[model samples]
Target: MNKSARFRQSIDFIEEHLYEDIPLEQAAQAGYTSLMQLYRDFYTYTGHSVKEYIRKRRLSGALGLIKTSQLPLAEIAYSCGYSSQQALCKYVKSATRMTPLAYQKSETCYFFPRFDSETIRQVTVTSETIPRTIQLKFYYPKQRGIEHQAVAALRTLLPEYEGRIFGRDGEPREGLFCYELAVEYDPEVLNRLAGSLGQELTEVPEFCSTFAKTAVRSDESEIGLAWDYLYLKWLRTSMFVQDDGRYFEEYLCKGGEVKKLLLYLPVRKRMDYDKISVICCADSKFLVSSREGEQAEEEASAAVLKVLSRHHPELIRTAREWYVARNGMIYTCGVRLEQAIELPADSGAEVLLAAAGRYAVLESSSCSDREAFTALLDAWIQENGWSKEDLPAFTTYETGGQAEPDAITMRVWIRLKDVKNG
Candidate 1:
């Protein structure tokens, strides 16, 4: 199996046996790798060591049971691999700064949908205008490997995040649901120091905001519940109201069984979509296959595979695929340029510059048929009263970006008119 698949296997093993004692050897064996190798790669991929990840997961799991069930604390502790109730309480306090009794009381007194209200440490309210932020746009769907691009962006733009992620969920751009993962930097300083990078800029107006962090895993419904609480409960009770502006979620680390997500929702005293500044795309390097015509699809596939085999055979790790339309034709196979290097001439692979500008994006899985995909995009564009722009459309593969042509998933991007000034 490929590295991504192997890593998934290892994570699956850990999640399955989370309530039990898991040794490093077992996890390594699950991945078909060595202890040291798994240890190193695990940290690189998940931003947490095996031991640390397991501990946090166990605590979170135990806390969930404690809040929902009538089971005694001792039983919950033992079931969650804790030695005793006392041990569970100690661990909980250390992690969340709350005792079991206190946590339970808070849960009883108040709640935030799927999450316990007490677990919410604090919701800091701020009413400052958000400065211009730089973000890399990419697609995130209910699939694998797409997140790698986001991680790559974080590493390139914000090294401080390490492998951790901080992102703003964006509405569908083009025909895909695109996310703008912000680069942590002062926009003014970046513009002053390197104004060229400002092409990736987006600005937000002043608004009232509530911020909270939770040990909730990304896969859980509680994450959505937290958002719902901010909107349904917190915002409903406060004087502030949600505007058309986008809310943000900062992921401290990539999702596994343990993730600390800082959720933020900036509410406005009044709606101000017009007051908000429009954000444009940043310049990007794209490695695209150029084949167009009656046989373009077949020819493009062969060309992309040829390029990969010659220059980047290592990228053939997964079956992810991507495509985009341009000049009345399609580029059958695609990947962001930074993911690959050392392109050989006449191999059907060329580096193209993608200009910074507005675009509509939409996410589609490999499983969807062409008609369904197109229909979805059509509905979204029409409903939102959006129009296509004069720029070329594109897509990026979610998998290794090279594989058998049929096994790929992709995100499509269509250019949009510069509506910010309009």
Candidate 2:
């Protein structure tokens, strides 16, 4: 069977035995894989370990029974695989900060539903980084036909200048709602435009740093459907929760007509992480050279580039390196390769394997403070109930078609600890 189908089979086994004791080995056997592989595949696919997934499903099932049936709490707990009513109560209270009786009396429910291959296939979600920008906001009161009024105002005002535009729905204040139309321009230019239009300009130093984005066509009559799908459907099933940042839409306008737009929903990790995604790297080879001491990274990179230029100059653009702290500092520089190649015996290079696995990734536009970036990622990993694997973490450098230092960016990838062992 295919990997996804086998993964679904394992999920089916979990659902079938949720109310019973399920041995980890048995669960792995259901998918025809070893326990370690099963753990890796489960976390990669569902963003949750098998044990955690089962615990959450049981909790959700118990909550459903409490709301609909008049069964005793002890019986409900027993059926949900909890040893005692007290144990179930403790779980509920820890997750929802409410006692079981209190939760039943109130209207609140904590539910983490089951996920299968079909559900994963249907849901489309992606992470995005929103750059810092300046904006001029226009607000409109909440009422029927306010959307039309906002659009008319935008059509009237857009002809004054040209730049990126965005729209957002704001919170209500004193029974009045707000619809903001944002234009990306310099503060000085936006100040002039605001003056001509008799509106005040608001300079936003930082936009939403991270967002969950989806594309939507402007031809859709009601954009509310997209929002509904994102919040009501996708949010409930995904490993992300809504963040405090404002949600907005980026308009792709042509001749004052919006042909399409991107809907950006501010989101943080449902768990302790910020914005986390999984990446699988293929097993590859790298031509590597290592150095140690102060300025080791720069010296190593320059040394590798010098070697590559003498031997294989065309591979410089594909350069990357790993930074490790040994006695003081150590940096290994190289170009990754998809296949093995013969090298000169005198060349100062060694072959290193970049092992294949699912890695948790974090990216930064600035590589100046790598320690700060790594510290943040390490805290996120531990807080989100994950451990770092005993693998070398690495950074990749990419150029933005410029030789300037500001044009280079870095991304960090660290392997996650195996769930079965963690």
Candidate 3:
């Protein structure tokens, strides 16, 4: 097996024996690697020693049982590979600063999810340049129930059009988001068909910049997951940075069913250097939680938005979102506010100090990919010779930018250590 496969095998072995005594040598033997090499691999990839990984995994499993089941503490401890209930309590307190009983009553919990290698192989990203083409653009308001309208329009147009169709979810403009369906058609042919079609036909200029492209199923869930992995995981480690160009999808329809599409993201070579300003805030309020599962962050964000809409409607337009990730799992998500406001007792919000410090900020007109923006900001921090602080980072959406009227700018903030000087 290759390196990733070997590491995956070792991880599988460790996971299978998480509730049992897992020796470092046995885990290494499962992957046909030496114990020393296994230690290095775990640290390099997962940022945890093998022993630490096992311990955290055990704690995570035990905590799940603690919060959900009424099992006795001693039984829970033994089932999760703990020697006794006292040992489990000691580690839980050290990690979360809460006793098991107290933690069960708390609103938040820390969970370290398993590492899956299959995610790395799910989507393959390649670089390409798309030539200039003619496109039919469809504009729509940025509101609910617009997706069905767009899909209906595409269904009507796809049967008649014989060329390639591309879809783009454009940046917000005057409280509107454009959903353009482009087709490769001859100018003369489009001229005759433009009048019959209600939408505008525009000639897209040639794009010389390179783009990162990946193939994905056209289903909504798969597309969302692909984008999440791209922005949240891949971009942080990539050598290229996201460019200031629109991303789009090339649809592949068969038998009246759209099955797959090519997702394209504009990218450019990483600059040798870049600098950003730091914004400081005093305090903020948030509705926060550390949960598990693939949709945990999305669900938490939606809940925060719902509460804000009900209690603080005025702040909904410019609300900020934050997340906390440890050991490659994003375990926390919620809304953050810079302004101090008293929430009603039923608001379900908590106060979190927005510690005053220097931060690296990356502003983008497109708020669809906050994770990618944060990844770019992280790359900037590394390129500009700044160290990141152990603080929660966030992205704030500010409306009305200089670029356009009603334009929304997403500012990603990552706290930094003091600047190093020669």
Candidate 4:
């Protein structure tokens, strides 16, 4: 078999038998290769050692169950192939700073995005939320090109105010590239900077944000891609909408083998807008598990594993989770390509096509946090002056490339009807 097929086979085997005590030899056999070859290929493709990958996947699985299901911790641990609930707890606390019980009690979902590539930059993206902050911002026009001079002057004059630098292109003023160099404001520092450096204090209101840190020098050049990826891809589908506020990048440590940058964009959980984009989704096959109620369809999604074990063995490890809500009924599912061998024909599987119309799309995980979804909906409806139609909402999953686990992006679309006029 080709390299792609081998990797798929290996992943499929691992995912299939994740609940079982799978040996390396068994995984290799599933991939139709020697253990050594499987080891090398798995590492190359996933940037994770076979053992590490299995552990992380299992932990992720355990987390999902812990967060979404009524299942007991011991049951979750056993189902995720852990020796005991204590083992699961130890790993959970080690990886995330919270215990399983603590995590479950909290309103936050611990399902952060995962990275799967070795060549790409190794940057960690984490959610940053602060209630209220005030900053003194200094502006320099692009034409003057005095940003460095301004920064240098401020650094020299106030030496203690080593603030962050922010850049903006064509906003508030046309054809002007401006930098909003900011320092966490102290009345004393603000007074000193204004008197000495002559920069103004700009009010940056309370908001939630995201922060990215570049881990290695090799990952430095790729940091720009990470920034673009977050802004272009992540923000669109996220619960938060970009507010009319400051967006900036801060250099944490300069001229070091290990570099760090904190990119900040001011965001509100949602905004009201009556405008909607009419989208046309192609007809596709979905391996679905049916569910009731408005909760995230994680329980129903389990059906995907069963379908994979039977019908489309190739996609067992490869497909990302998906969801389709018809007439408000949720179906936890994943998309299947047409070329893949068709099975589940008699298994009550369904084909879905999202009807084209005006839709308000929120990009989130297939199994998204319920609170976040509710907040987004409330804010969106209020802001848009638009109300939902009778049509069903659908969540679509795109991995962006071939079968890479961490490449998933889930988008939920709510159909809107009739714009309210002011």
The number of the candidate with the highest TM-score is 3
**Mind sharing the TM-score for model 4?**
0.34
Off-target runs (Cα >4 Å) in candidate 3 are 1-118, 121-127, 139-155, 158-160, 171-177, 272-422
Whole-structure CA lDDT of model 4: 0.56
- The list of candidate 4 runs beyond 4 A from truth reads 1-16, 20-116, 127-150, 162-174, 195-200, 205-223, 229-247, 253-260, 265-422
Candidate 1 residue 275 Cα shift, in angstroms, is 26
Candidate 2 Cα misplacement greater than 4 A, ranges: 1-112, 116-127, 137-152, 155-162, 171-177, 219-221, 271-422
Model 2: per-residue Cα lDDT over 1-422, one tens digit each: 88788878888888899999998898889989899888767645665557878988898788767755799999999999999999999988877677888877763435454674342222233455454444544455645555446656766755655677677765555566666666655655555566644254566654435565666777444467777766655554456678897778887877767777778777765752222344566775777778887887777767767777887776665443333322247888766665556778777777777678767666645455445445545554554456778876676655564356356656666788657228
Candidate 3, after superposition: displacement of residue 90 in Å? 49
Q: What is candidate 1's lDDT per residue for 1-422, written digit by digit as tens?
A: 77767767778888888888788788889989989877765434443456766776687567666655789999999999998889999987765566887876542211111111221223444444443444556665532333445555445544443333457655665565566666445654345424332234554333344322223346436677777656545443233455565677666664232256667665554221100011357977656677878888677768777777777877655434445554655545555555547765666677777777866555433433343334444444443445666565565556533344445445556666765223
lDDT of 3 by residue, 200-288 (tens): 66777655666666678767777777777666555533435688977788877777666787777776654322223555554555555
- Distance (Å) between predicted and true CA of 234, model 1? 42
* lDDT values for all models: 0.56, 0.65, 0.65, 0.56
TM-score of each: 0.29, 0.38, 0.43, 0.34
Clashing pairs in 3: none
Give the C-alpha miss distance for residue 377 in model 1, angstroms: 2.3
